[model samples]
Target: MKAERRTQWLRGVLDLCILGVLYDGEYYGYAISQRLEQAGLGHIKGGTLYPLLARLEEMSLVTSRWTVRQQGPGRKYYVLTEQGRRVFEEQASDWTMFAEHVATLIYRRGE
Candidate 1:
């Protein structure tokens, strides 16, 4: 039950986290996954991240381009679109408020 709820919460914020990372600069799929993991979001697999990237693209929140490397196969890099920047700002504000409210509730002392 607790784990399920945690999973739900993570799912809700995954998009925001992804956007936050991309807001910095473009990154390939594996690099994005590594960044998330390094940020303590845990290891997000390609199975999960790729579809989210696709969805963001479909929504016009992001754009991708393929870049070829001499040592290996080409990689698809993703960048946040202008629309995505606006959306990220809005979502980040909402998350801040929501997190503060949750923290207050969780830390409240009984009167």
Candidate 2:
């Protein structure tokens, strides 16, 4: 179905989307998910978001720290590293070019 294909496409670029969100500043897991949803990414679950965060951390693209809140347990906040910024910049450029090409192909006029 179209929805399923859309989900697959979204997954393919989820990392870039996450990096874009983090580019602004640090965010906790829940906050990241919410921001992505607000940005039209739809409802991304904790299961999916957490593992990606872990992978980004493992790749040294992001760093995290636990901040204790007054009313509840601590939350782990993630921030983009210098390397992440570079990666994001490169990836964003690549994505823009790729998207333009795809759009052109999709909208091409018949000769």
RMSD in order of candidates: 1.7, 1.3
> What TM-scores do the predictions have?
0.93, 0.95
lDDT of 2 by residue, 1-111 (tens): 477886899889999999999999999999999999998878898889999999999999999999989998999999999999999999999999999999999889794
Q: Give Cα-based local distance difference scores for all models.
A: 0.94, 0.94
lDDT for model 1? 0.94
